[model samples]
Target: MKLREEDLMDILVGATILGCGGGGSLEEGWKLIKRELKKGRKFRLVDVDDVPNDKIVASPYYVGSLGGNSKDNLAVKSFILLEEFIGEKFFGVVSTEMGGHNTAAALTTAAELGLPLIDADMAGRAVPELHHSVYYIRGYNMCPFSVVTAYEDKIIFSRTRDDLHAEKLVRSIVKVTGANVGVTSHPIRGKIFKRTIIRNAISLAMDIGKSVRKAKEEDKNWVLSLLELGGFLLFKGECVYMERREGSGFTIGEFELQVIEFYLKMRT
Candidate 1:
């Protein structure tokens, strides 16, 4: 898969739109994606059929406190470090946990690597922990997982017999990275991918993004336009409560109205 230099911004915009309010801020995801684009990496989106059945596929993304660090900073380049540790050309596949940011994180990596991203993810919705992926439920091992963080000063490498252990080790590394570290996990074979992945998610995200962009430009009502585009409203409410914490690690939290109405778990 070869990426063109021009499409990265549109892709990032679309990914953030899919985030449904909870994904990482668009400023952060776009800043990292754009920097990679400037570095001359053009990514391609890959279909599940394109990967070999026996080869390993991994998902890399950001994990951190989404509160205090909400502002955009173009200096963040954690994905490169994670990719460096893997020490191979990667095909950015979305993590099983779905959010605006993770979905975009997959494409941004794909664009930067000039590789075709897999259309599927392990989980179809946002999840709080690493072990929550559908891949683990199917008994897949998490070998070849790498955790990279700026403060860690070194890439953490692991070949785990179980995904849970991989999660445990990576979470420890997240602390070193200051609550928001980039992680890549879930190596899978191409053959198993046919059965396990939510196919064409990248393209779907792009299409959704295009529609939203059109709607915004045409001055159409956002909610109505989204509905017209076949996206269901998952939630709609004013923020009534919010909080923050610094426990074992940095923590940020918020609550808003019309709960779960906008949470559309895209089908593979």
Candidate 2:
């Protein structure tokens, strides 16, 4: 599917909701999209099943805590370096996870590389650690991964003891490289990727986004429509208290919602 401006906004809205407050910022995602659009780049998504079995694909994402000041094209740079190191062209780019920024990172990388963005991702939701991916859970190796820091420090791991160790190593690097880096990892053939990925996840987000947009356009109740689409009304309240801190390359935070009422139900 070719994504237009409206489609980008819809995806961002849906992905942000799915991110559960951890997928990077919507403003960052929009900036990436607008930058690519200004360059006349096309954003396209392809189904996993449509990929050839022999084709090679990789997941591109950012790793580190929120809030950073880096002007380098880190994700794209990492992807290019990985392709050079592997001596093989990537057939497509898959997202590491769905979120405002990560999804935009993957999409922009695909656009810059003139490749299709796979509609699937390693994780259906934004996760805090590298080990929290479906690929890791399915025993996929994240070897030969490339990491590019904001300061232009590039490293590639031919092997790692495990995904958890990989996460630790990257976090340690982040401490010196401005607390953020772009990563391209888990280079896998389309066959294994299809089996391990959270299939149609992008489509799911797009559908939710479209529903919400339609609701807004028709002046309908978006919350009700979302519930009808299998969303649960978890809470209707105001955040009475909130605190957040950055540590260990992760955002540690807490919030208390003052509930007006608890209306939890699943629409049939």
Candidate 3:
């Protein structure tokens, strides 16, 4: 499906919620979307099954803490380098995780490259470490990955000891790159990609976004709409305290929610 600005808004809203407060900021995501739309770029979403089995897809995303001022087009550069290194044209671009920033990153990359954006991702939600991806959990190789920084530093890992080592090595690079970098990795054929990915995740996010938007338009309770969409209302509270810091290439923090109400459902 061809994506419009409204679709991008829905994606931003849904992915932000799915990010669980870790996939960069909503502002950054919107900035990227607006920039692309302003440039007359077109975004397209394709289902996993629609892609030819022989086709190759790659995940392009931003890695590191949410706090950063880097404005370089690192993700696009990483994709270009990876495609050159692999000597294969990518059929589509897949998101590394479902988040405001990363999802937009993948979408913009696809739009810029004139490739379709796959409606799937490695992780259905944002995760802090590379090893948390389904690709890593399923024992998929993460080599031949490209990492590029805003400062024009680039490295392609032809091999790694394991996912853990890859994570460590990337973190070390991130520490020097101002806490963020762009990465493209996990090049897989469509057959294996469909099996390993969190399929239809983008659609799910879009659905959630559409529901909330409809509720708002109808002057209904968006929270109730979310509940109807299979989301649990854990608590309604004000954040009394938050301590966030960028350390070791990760954003570590804790927050306390002073509960105003809590909801629990009983199943029988």
Q: Which candidate is the best by lDDT?
A: 3
What is the C-alpha local distance difference test score of each model?
0.59, 0.85, 0.87
Ranking by TM-score: 3, 2, 1
List the candidate 2 regions with Cα displacement exceeding 4 Å: none
CA shift at 2, candidate 3, in angstroms?
0.4
Tens digits of per-residue lDDT, candidate 2, 1-268, equal: 8988888888887887788887788788879889999999999989999989998999888888767432467999999999999999999999888788888889899998899999887889888888888988888878889999977889999998988999899988887665679999989998888888899888888888888999999999887778766888777889999998887777789999899988766455
Listed in order, each prediction's TM-score against the native is 0.75, 0.95, 0.95
Q: Local error of candidate 1 at 251, Å?
A: 3.8
| lDDT (Cα, tens digit) per residue for candidate 1, span 1-268 | 4545445555555556655554566666666666666777666766788787766567777666554241232112444544466565444465444565666576666665555677666765556667776777777765555554555444545566576766666666666556566666665667776787777655655666667677788998755666765666555666667665644333555665545346565523
By lDDT, highest first, what's the ranking?
A: 3, 2, 1
Cα lDDT over the full model 3 = 0.87
Superposition TM-score, candidate 3 onto the true structure: 0.95
Where model 1 places Cα greater than 4 Å from the true spot, the runs are 1-7, 67-96, 152-162, 176-179, 233-236, 244-250, 258-268
Question: What number of clashing residue pairs does each candidate have, in the order they appear?
Answer: 14, 0, 0
True-structure Cα RMSD, model 2: 1.4
